[model samples]
Target: MAANVEDFKKRLDEQDLHIRESWVAAMKARIVRGELIKCQRGEGVNHYKHCRDLAEMYTGMIRENKVKGYKIIDTE
Candidate 1:
């Protein structure tokens, strides 16, 4: 039983890694699609970091399994 548990955990880790990579890819795509254009809340806002911030917000909500916690913060 212990062996089985370890195997399951390992598999889950692998799957989660894949999901994380996918989320990062999707976030990049979203940013490339003009999703980060003028994403500031007001004047004197960010210009370069907004893309990364928005991408992190988007990826935070994505999940590949129920064991993961999804925290989505509005960036735009």
Candidate 2:
């Protein structure tokens, strides 16, 4: 019984770590996305030129799976 309880506690701790890691990744992604948006917020046609670096950073982050469920739409 004691071993079972320890196992359950260990599993719960692992789950907590997983949840924290996911949350941290999401928060970091949100900041990165916000920076990219801010860079392009009102640039219009010039956004491509002005925001290229941020866009590249965002794309790299996504490609590296630093965020979930996002992908680069185009490189043109």
Name the best candidate (by TM-score): 2
Tens digits of per-residue lDDT for model 1, 35-72: 54556443235655656776565556443222333344
- Model 2 stretches with alpha carbons more than 4 Å out: 42-44, 62-76
User: Could you tell me the lDDT of residue 15 within candidate 1?
Assistant: 80
TM-score of 1: 0.44
Each candidate structure's TM-score, on Cα atoms with residue i matched to residue i, is: 0.44, 0.68
List the RMSD of every prediction in angstroms: 10.8, 8.3
lDDT of each: 0.59, 0.76
lDDT, candidate 2, 1-76, per-residue tens? 9999999899888777766776787677678889889878878779999999889877876666453322247778
Error of 2 at 57 (Å): 2.6
Report lDDT (Cα) of residue 71, candidate 2.
28
Best by lDDT: 2
Candidate 2 minimal-lDDT segment of 10 residues: 63-72
Lowest summed lDDT window (length 10), candidate 1:
62-71
